[model samples]
Target: MSIDAFVIGIFFVTIHLLANELIPADRIKRLRWLSFSGGLAVSYVFVYVLPSLHREQHQLKDYASTFTMESELYFIGLLGLLLFYGIENSVSYAQAKGFAEYHAFFWLQVGFFAFYNMLIAYTVMASEIKGVQAVFYGAAIGLHFIAVAHDLWRKDPDRYRKVGRYVLASGIFVGWGIGTSLQLSSVMQSLIFAFISGAMILNVLKNELPKERDAHFPTFAFAIISYTSVTLALKYFFEW
Candidate 1:
């Protein structure tokens, strides 16, 4: 299990780096590929993450002194959703204004996503499921990350190519290094998964559901329908 995680971590980093370089510039192509990515991500959250979080509440009783709730993780997930939505809007506002006074805000986006990457990398590496299950997750996440990287590049080309990609790419290795060494309790793991699940929802939808900017509706719909069907099949029948 440990070796699998470490190896998968390396593969995750490679794919993230490749996403910055390899994804194409066509609108249709982007949507066709990313729709599946977004659907898979969202499906994982609904079918796996939500149920796991609900089942993990007992692990968080030690946190009762801090708060009391059967669904605190869900609450945390909501915060994660709001946080990214706010940042996404703020960054868009700054970019529309020519990013003059607010170039620092672009860096803020980088900083926020660096932590996001680290969180995701840590989660992927720390997962109890190894082999193909972990690889499936990491690759699906890599495709979603490609959308995020595109958004960043679209917002600021020079900076993303020069700096932002490097930051997020580095986060994977850093997170993996940290995760492999840490022995977090179940509560900590639950909180991390909750936050990622929420962030994934916001990030994928924001990019995928936009109808403007030549969004490919046909491809998007197909990807969503196909990927969701496959994911549900695996969950219910194959027991994956």
Candidate 2:
């Protein structure tokens, strides 16, 4: 595995642990949006801008070094954190104002964004693969979506609101299966996966958010497990 991949994987795992287990829930709500936004800015600088700068400096061979900055993975991670903060705050505000249904879609939107960006990050990291590797990758992604679906199923009543998420998950699973069967190029597979994942997250955030807080811990656990499982699965699949 490339240094970039290794670093990214580690960063994901660390953050997942921190956000899910280490960080106190009370403090999480108090987290500032600026902190997340600053992280996003740093991520953009490292993942997107740094590589280009390094390439210009004729240090293209150190691409892995540039890529391993945790920016790519953390971009969406911080975004999800921000969204979570936003939803919680919005919900609290709405409740204070007696607008229960006003920001009900906030939670749903957060879930969708998290799932979607996670898929994109996964695809971005998935640069090469063979048969079993592809299957494992697909399965890992499918499982994450399944987690999201389970969360949705347990929460909302609006059937129509959940439809898009389900469709997005199913589409990616099917696309991944087909891509694996046909032995598609890494770039093609990644692009297709990224597109679907981005679309799902974007649409869900734009549409609605979820309300219930009972599933927060489970959702956090699922995300951490998903990240770890996918990394281990990918490593094994590649026989690395």
Candidate 3:
């Protein structure tokens, strides 16, 4: 567990550095990789995370009696979706209304995503999911993080370069530190994973489905179909 946490934590921070500081955005775009990466992310969320979340709901059945554990956990995922949607769109609305001067929206984004990263870090570090499953999930998230770091930098290059980058990058490690040191109860852990799963859906789609962005459909399609197929095949073959 410690080794997994350490590897994920260190690798996440390293990717942020590459995405935010080391690489030029145009060259990054020219790589034409985000779509395929986004597809892998969406595939994992749909094919793996969502199922795990549902199973987790069952695990919490004994403790929560008011509502079906399934519904409650799904609600957590929905709440995550709405919260991030508001955070992202609110910033855009503020910027569009000539309110960029306030900079509050920008900072709000920072705070929300810092927490977002921490949530994911906590979930990944502490969850029982391991081996190939863990690798698939982690790879998808690593790609997703690059998109996020790139977006934050684009939003306010000066601020992100000056301070925001480091702040966001550190969030993963902070969450890992907390998660490793403390074990959350089963229900709480399940809820948190559901929330992160929801957030991942929103983050990946918002970046990939933008109308203004040029998309490589073939690459994207290939990623989704192939990864999904591989995951399915793995399940059937390994009976995992």
- By lDDT, the best candidate is 3
Per-residue lDDT of candidate 1, residues 1-240 (tens digit): 377787777776665555556765544465456555555656656666667667666678778886587778888888888988888788789878776767788888888898888998888767656766666666667667777787787777888778778888898888887788886876788888888778878886677554446455566566667766766776687576
Choose the strongest candidate by TM-score.
3
The residue pairs that clash in candidate 2, if any, are 105-208, 105-209, 106-209, 106-210, 107-209, 107-210, 108-209, 108-210, 109-209
When superposed on Cα atoms, how far off is each prediction in RMSD?
2.8, 12.7, 2.2
Tens digits of per-residue lDDT for model 2 on 1-240? 444444444434333223323433334442232233222322333333334333333432345664455244334344544655565456456657776674455455544445554454455355544455444443343333333343343344344244534444343444333423345554344334434433434323332222233224344444445545555565567643
lDDT score, candidate 2, position 37: 23
Model 1, residue 127: displacement in angstroms?
1.5
Off by over 4 Å in 1: 26-28, 58-67, 210-218, 237-240
TM-score of every candidate: 0.85, 0.37, 0.89
40: Cα error in model 2, Å: 28
Q: How many residue pairs clash in each candidate?
A: 0, 9, 0
lDDT of 3: 0.79
Error of 3 at 146 (Å): 0.7
| Whole-model lDDT per candidate | 0.73, 0.41, 0.79
Query: Which order, best to worst by TM-score?
Result: 3, 1, 2
- The candidate with the higher lDDT, 1 or 3, is 3
Q: Which lDDT value does model 1 have at 238? A: 56
1 versus 3: better TM-score goes to: 3
What does the lDDT come to for candidate 1?
0.73
